[model samples]
Target: MKDLFDEIDTHQPERQPIGEGAVLLRGYALQLGKDLLPSLHDIGAAAPFRHMVTPGGFEMSVAMTNCGQAGWITDRAGYRYDSHDPVSGKLWPPMPDAFLDLATGAAREAGYPEFSPDACLINRYEPGARLSLHQDKNERDFANPIVSVSLGLPATFQFGGLKRTDPVRKFALRHGDVVVWGGPSRLCYHGVPTLKHGSHPQLGSVRFNLTFRKAL
Candidate 1:
């Protein structure tokens, strides 16, 4: 926690890919099917996705919800892992098979074949939305890798180091692109840059990101 997280409540990090692990697959998974679009609506039905507040009290630009054994939530209680949706007081939506299949496949393709993520953070970013740079240190275990799938309007992905002082590497992530980072790079600070204004025929003016992780 340095000057980095100070304005973390309001800083737009740069965009770049840190290493070879960051791959832009460009439409590699577009063949997943059109029904997948409505699948999100179903997922939201159970979780009732919302814009979560950061520990700093600022609202996140990205509307996030989850579907799995655990969901990521933040309130006055601070950012921590929870098993139930605060909105419905019920367990989060079940992770879809398509999502699980795609996640595990991407991990194996990235060389982490044994990945079994129990938490999936679904982010929806409309035009002008952005995520601040922060490490995924809240998870209970660091042994598992982070699997992120990007879809819709392209956004810059900033990957940094263990310390706030460390400079960042950025990459432009587009539809169907998946990035997996773990091992020596598992505890890195990463986030999305300011989303550009654009419209995707499938997702409209919004960008959907699936960040699959093993919370426990």
Candidate 2:
């Protein structure tokens, strides 16, 4: 598998917001609301969301699905990548151009310079769902930044440093917000705070996230 950077490198333009090594691009998807949900539904139809059990035998609070060449998985067997979806024995869903474009743009904005992603992990957070602080360390490469986009109800994003005990900067993310962090901050700890019970007129009570990565 070729890095998405191979195809998206020369297209990076200085159009996104940059901060230190991270970048925050806001309202980048508001114009595509009509298309985004349906596209996500198509992806779900292909790779359906399911709650995964962690190595510790605890069910992960978040519901997840995937699109692209690989999907992140955790279980008693530990974290790893597989081309076939365990639930369906079929190839995982394909990442749409919209997802790819968004990820590439956000990553470049985050100073990755040349960003290309092969896996897009789509996570769904309903009321009460929360992910504990953790580092993204299972990917085949750390040179790529993780591009995360939010949709639906607002969520509190916790961005911490390289250490698990590091203090975190919490940000309130509403629908259509995109956050990209890489470089020295790529392995920094991060997670969503407990989701508040609420309903978004557009997406009901569910919050959706698209996390772009380069996994093979």
Candidate 3:
């Protein structure tokens, strides 16, 4: 099965539109993958990834961190964007130029131009880590698109409708793939299924996701 997946992983990237205003730019980050790694390393070092507890006091299995003017965080206060990391009580690391550029370019390619993201949430998932279906409503504006970049191990992304019970469409997201959704589909529910154990040539035993949003 690994061999089969590996074989299929070599296929060329393509643009896939999943809904009225959502599109997937497969392998869109391949050209800049090398630059992303070191940038992530530095950012992670400054703002190490850690599992956060929800408002209900449930710990999230997926570890996360952030960069840019504001960073997404959750605790007793609830899920919201903050300029400071609650852990260190200091300002979050500034978003790397490379990250900003990649996000802007990807958003522009997906029909959303002039996107200036103020918050970037970086998620790290290991085997068994999963995210339930939810909408991104914490941001101040819904007009700007959400640009998400996938890297490392491949995973299944669940893109659902406005309601929680809406039927979902799963997409195999490989390293370097970028998913962008906004406008009419901005409030759609989406999530990541449990990650299967596997190793990629570049990243071993882990998957990194970068989601850019215009958070105030």
Candidate 4:
């Protein structure tokens, strides 16, 4: 992949507050972008991305895979986290050091210094792929914040209130952007809208999101 950091201007990291306990760290992950992709590629090779089916039997638009101690999955049974990948029948690949560092650093910067994630959900979105608004309540603990890193193409992120029908605010997330939400906003409904058709010089037409959470 080409070095996108070189093409973009070097600037101080900017923090944009999204809610009472949520923030958007603009260009916060650029420092680690070059190393992240290679580690992600290795993890994907071990446990390939697959579109999972929801409990309602509908297939998801985004392809997903995971690293660390647990991997999230959904099916007729329901949504839950498992130590083993259902398809491979083996433990999910270990989370890379760089991934852990990025997650912890971002969380700390967002005011959650004790965040230690056990699961990192990797979501791949192609043109037109989207994620529906949902809460991250499947995890056992709600105290840990969610650290989501955006890579490749840009996307529109929808952040809503506690209830599903609550008002929502949209934010434009570009490559190397990270969002952290915890405390009272940990269970807030959030998702990505349909990805626009565009080619990112480094990552082609796909957008990859790495969401770190404490699943256990």
Candidate 5:
């Protein structure tokens, strides 16, 4: 209950960069947080998180699901990347080699080396969930690099820029924090803001992000 790398080796997480091929490796999954929270609860017991709907139909308060070889989805014909699991159509839960070696070792420690992610998604905030800035551009290659990975509670990311009114920079993600971004910040405009009310002794009030893309 208390050894998530003991306060991350008693301070010294700093990697933080921010743009141009981004960075933020802080705590880098805190020693793999006991193997990435039981392989993300066994890939959510085989893809079972929901809240999707949004091609203007509007419904997504952040509950999602996924693994590898594709995942991120949405409805009304939009937001792609799907290898099935349009709700148990199956085939969407297999990427857990500790989530492909913690997203290929956090995209080679934020420098993007052999990062072979296929897609991971898996968000799941709670206290008034919210993710707005945008610009992931539905994968298929933005030159790769988008590792994300915080685990429970604590949010506030919003790294904006490259348009949409630019100038953002919130940060604060906690639990294992990873964030990678990509060359030219890979289309920048990040998000995740409205999640407050806490409690996380191991994911209590909830907040489990993950992201990791390379979606083909």
Candidate 6:
């Protein structure tokens, strides 16, 4: 059987509008792939990725870690941003310059020029891991945009309207694709479906998502 990842279109970078304020920048982060991966490794070595439990006591399928000033966390206490890693009991690793540059550049390309993210939630998805449709509302400001970069295996991205029941549009997100949404689409619901089994040259069988947000 042919691998699913082999079918993904390795296209050139281009700006694609998915909503009023949301854009999928195809192949936007391809140039940064080399630098970003190594930085991700260092950050993971520092904080490590672990499955977090939701306030409802359900364990999340995705393994997560973070960099920057704050990290988004969920537990019995509820979903919120914390400055320290819950497991390490220390401040999250500093956001690398390459991460900030890529996020800022992508946000600008998506028409959010002033976006300066302070928190980066890194989610690692293995086969069968999925995320439920949800809104990112834990941040202090909705004026800032959300910048998400995809790496490794390809996955389906679910972007919906403001309501959970609203119609959702799925997009095939491959390595180096970046999605930025804010303004009218800042609070839109979004998620990932269960990832299919696949392997990548760099990341093996895992996929990584770097979500940048302004959480001060």
Predicted model with the maximum lDDT: 4
How would you order the candidates by TM-score, starting with the best? 4, 6, 3, 2, 1, 5
lDDT of each: 0.77, 0.80, 0.90, 0.93, 0.83, 0.92
Worst 10 residues of 4 by lDDT: 1-10
Instruction: Between candidates 4 and 5, name the one with more favorable TM-score.
Output: 4
Candidate 6 lDDT, tens digit per residue, 103-186? 999998899899999999999999999999999999998999999999889999999999999999999998889999999999
Task: Output the TM-score of candidate 6.
Answer: 0.94
Clashes of each: 6, 2, 0, 0, 0, 0
Best by TM-score: 4
lDDT of 3 at 134: 95
- How well is each residue in 79-162 modelled by candidate 3, as lDDT tens digits? 899999988998999999889988999999999997999989999999999999999999998999999999889999999999
Supply the global lDDT for candidate 2.
Answer: 0.80
- Candidate 4 achieves a global lDDT of 0.93
Candidate 5 residues 1-216, lDDT tens each? Answer: 664445554565668888888988777777664667777788898888889999889998889998887888999899898798887788887787777787888788778887798878888889998988989988877888888888778888989888989799888978888889888989989898799988888668998888888888
lDDT tens string, model 2, 1-216? Answer: 332122222332324433346766665555332556778999998888999999899999899988888888888999987777899999888888888777776665556658889998999999999988998899978877889989888999888888999888888887877888888888989999899999876688999999988886
Looking at model 2, report the run of 10 residues with the lowest lDDT sum: 3-12
Per-candidate Cα RMSD to the true structure, in Å, reads 9.7, 6.8, 3.8, 1.2, 16.1, 3.6
- Lowest lDDT 10-mer window, candidate 6? 1-10
lDDT string, candidate 1, 165-189, tens digits:
7889888777766788887788878
What's each prediction's TM-score?
Answer: 0.86, 0.88, 0.93, 0.97, 0.32, 0.94
